[model samples]
Target: MAHVRSSAIRARLDWVRVHHGQARVEEVIGALDRHELAIRGAASPNLWIPFDAYVALNTEIDRRFGIGDLSLCRVLGRYTAEVNLPTLYRIFYKIGTPTYILSKVSAVWSAHYDSGIASSRPVPDGVIIRVESFATPHRCMCLSVLGWLEQTVTIAGAELIDAREVMCRLRDGNACEFRLLYREP
Candidate 1:
């Protein structure tokens, strides 16, 4: 079974509690408990947890709070970047151009996920990221990545125009591809 950093799960739960209230979070936690997943309040951020549990948590969040289209997963992902990146990494975003920042996504991929290698290359107005070798892929995960990349460029002081997942392992078979277009700012 693939594993994900516990921080990912914690962040999602935190978002729910903050936005929906303690009762909603408790409800969500109850649902997850049925799946045998535990979200201890003091769980270590560096600890590893089952990736499917992470997915299940996201699925529940989307089902309860998200638009039926799963776009809220993308929003949650962008929120993750917003909340998580501005602290220690704010300087990197300020100093780097969008291209410079995006090109380094491959290096950062392994920090949050134990599966998948993200590779990127410069395109005309943006970057193309391909997430390959992901042992388990799902639509929620793909949308989250797409949103993260979009927010990343915006944080790097670029004006994002469009972003899309052109291919997904869930629908297309092998890898997931994301295209993000930006205007220099």
Candidate 2:
């Protein structure tokens, strides 16, 4: 398969992260969820893959390759801004980072831009809302997502001093909390 240029991919990811918006996040999340479900033997009729499975597969691949590099994981996290499944999948296998896969999924619901496709709406600030769970793997999922977000900001020529957990009201009446961090050049 033809590969996306690393620089171009990075630029696209940076664009999405910097221009985060709610609608874009929803759209990308829907797209990514659909793609994940389409994969063979994903999980169930709901078409959701377990977060742990996602992490294990990538971790296994990394172990097999004997490459302990985290660059691929970082890149995959960056790519989530675009909801580019093909690129994400390729990076998952090529770079072998479990954190990358989880971050990509979270980015689908957090980052409001599609690096693979153009959008007609304004991008929102990359605000990540974490859903707490007792599942250990799910916790890892949250960390991976935060890691990716931080990496994305750094790649965009900004610095993220700290990400503090805070509750933010969503469109729905229910309130969700995520690690809120500020960025500056």
Candidate 3:
């Protein structure tokens, strides 16, 4: 079973990385769309940061400053709406220590509002960083993750679909994977 699962994951990665050249989120989304994977709301016209670039940024920060308490890093992308559709900028953040792999961080937004009724504000979307202490095979972190995902999706009026896990380290020198996913409303 482990072999099969590993093989399946490898195959998926190969398809996404080799065949589709998923150097950017746009390419990954395109591949997903080509495979009939559903995405939340209308597609945005903005380009997504390449996974490597995003990782490099975080790794560099970690190496330079060392993990400190209350350190936050964010990656931003802009999506433009076409044909009366609302376009949103999705920002993903990597929070917490290197020894403990937690969750992915995401923020969904439409327009830029500072205050008042028309002020554009950031709506927290999905589990950005799944705390390692909270995740155990027996404990099933899915419930908590899903709870956060559901709330964010509901508030954003978007649909979220699949979740992907990326290997990362925690502050305690433990290796783990951080889970990330796309949603559809």
Candidate 4:
């Protein structure tokens, strides 16, 4: 299975702590703290965890968020804007159009997935990001990615038109394909 930086989980927890109640934030943080005995001692915020664990954390976030909707994705995306995107921005966003910046997505995504599970390419409308395999379906993750893409594009100075998943891995499609559509403002 693929792995993700624990930073993703920590960042979302920060968002929850600010917007949601403190108890729920602690609940999620506490759960991760208890993910294993050794982790309780001092898990590096940058440590890598299985992608499934990251997904599970997102699901728990939705549950405790009390809405259990794609809005959680919006929240995740907004938070991503504050932290993740800016770092990438400094590296990739040099007054480039969204298309130009997005052309670098394959590299950034590889750094996140840390495996060969993801790829991105420009299309007529925007971009197509593929997760080659996901044993389970996760709308929250998809939506969160969508939201992140939207924010990232906007930060790149593009006007986002729409974004959606056109193919689902669980639906027996070849891969989970997220289609993004945007245009320059």
Candidate 5:
């Protein structure tokens, strides 16, 4: 099974606690506990946990807090970048262009996920990120990535004009791609 770093899971729960309050965090943990994916206690930042558990956490967040279309997963993803980038990956944003950051995605991808190869290429007004070979990819996961990429551009000192998923492995069974259009600040 694919795995995600524990820090990613912790960040999701942290966002919930900060925005929704401690009670909601407990409710979320209760929901996940039913599925045997307990996340109430902290885990080692670098520990690898089942990616499915991460997905379950995202799904639960969307089910309770979102509008049922799963779009809120994207919002949660943007929050992930907001919480994570400034502390853990700040230097990349400080010195890297959007393109430079895109180039480093592959390396970053490996650290966060045990599956998938993430790569990017420059487009006319932005960049196209492609995620391939991810085991058990889901639309919620893809949308989260779209949000993450959009936020990353903003953190890199650019104004994001548009961002959307161009392709999804769930539909095409190949890979997922996101198109992000931005203007330099």
Candidate 6:
């Protein structure tokens, strides 16, 4: 499986546990093996983990909760929307209007996603984010990521903001594109 920074995955589990309590978390991580590649418990925010683990954890959460992808996005969206990121992003994301913040989206996303996924760059009005595919594996990830982007901007002082999955890779398009629109207060 591919590898991704642990910060992206561990934080979500921590959020789930912190907000929902241990029993709910144990319901998922307890049965999974924490291998040298992936730790079962709270992983270091900077640790490296197999991407499969991230996928597995989400899949397990959905199966365990009997929830759909949109609901899962809500869980993560609320968590991310409410918290300020580290010093760098807290300032970077808030310094500009929603459009400007999104113009810099690639800066932060680059840290979490591998190059194979796609590339992001600022467009004239919004931003263009392309992904490798929109298959089953990427469906939930795309939705949740969109949710995160929406909330991230919302907290950053944007009075109005919108993100849409305009193009889908599953639809035989070149890549999945998220169009960002916003009005600054």
Candidate 5's C-alpha runs over 4 A off are 34-38, 86-88
Decoy 2 TM-score against native: 0.33
Clashing pairs in 5: none
**Candidate 6 lDDT tens digits, 1-185:** 45556665666677767867878776677656654236463356666566667666766666666475545754564465455277776776677666666655555555665544555666654566666632334555666667777777677776435578888765666777777666565
Number of clashes in model 4?
0
Model 3 residue 65 lDDT score = 35
**TM-scores of all candidate predictions against the true structure:** 0.93, 0.33, 0.21, 0.81, 0.93, 0.78
- Model 3 lDDT tens row, 1-185: 00011221222233334434656334443434322232211233342322232233323332333352212121111001111122332221122221111121311211111111111112243334433322222111222233433333333444455433333333342333333343433
Worst 10 residues of 1 by lDDT: 33-42
Summarize candidate 5's per-residue lDDT along 139-167 as a digit string, tens digits: 77898888889888989898899999888
Clash number by candidate, in order = 0, 5, 28, 0, 0, 0
Per-residue alpha-carbon lDDT of candidate 2 for residues 1-185, written as tens digits (9 for 90 to 100) = 11122223233223334565545433433444433332234322233344443444333323333264423343344444334335555444345332233334444442322222211111133344444322232222333345555554444444556544343222232333444344434
Question: What is the lDDT of every predicted structure here?
Answer: 0.82, 0.37, 0.27, 0.69, 0.83, 0.62
lDDT, residue 34, candidate 3: 29
- Which candidate do you rate higher for TM-score, 1 or 4? 1
Q: Please, what are the lDDT tens digits per residue for candidate 1 over residues 24-60?
A: 9879878876444545532887787877787788888
Give the residue spans of candidate 1 off by over 4 A. 34-36
lDDT tens digits by residue: candidate 4, 87-158: 655555646787776666677666665664667788987988787764455676667767777777877777
Worst 10 contiguous positions by lDDT, candidate 4 = 33-42
- Residue 99 lDDT (model 4): 78
Ranked by TM-score, the better of candidates 4 and 5 is: 5
In model 3, which range of ten residues has the least summed lDDT?
Answer: 74-83
Off by over 4 Å in 3: 1-128, 134-142, 164-178, 183-185
* lDDT: the better of candidates 4 and 5: 5
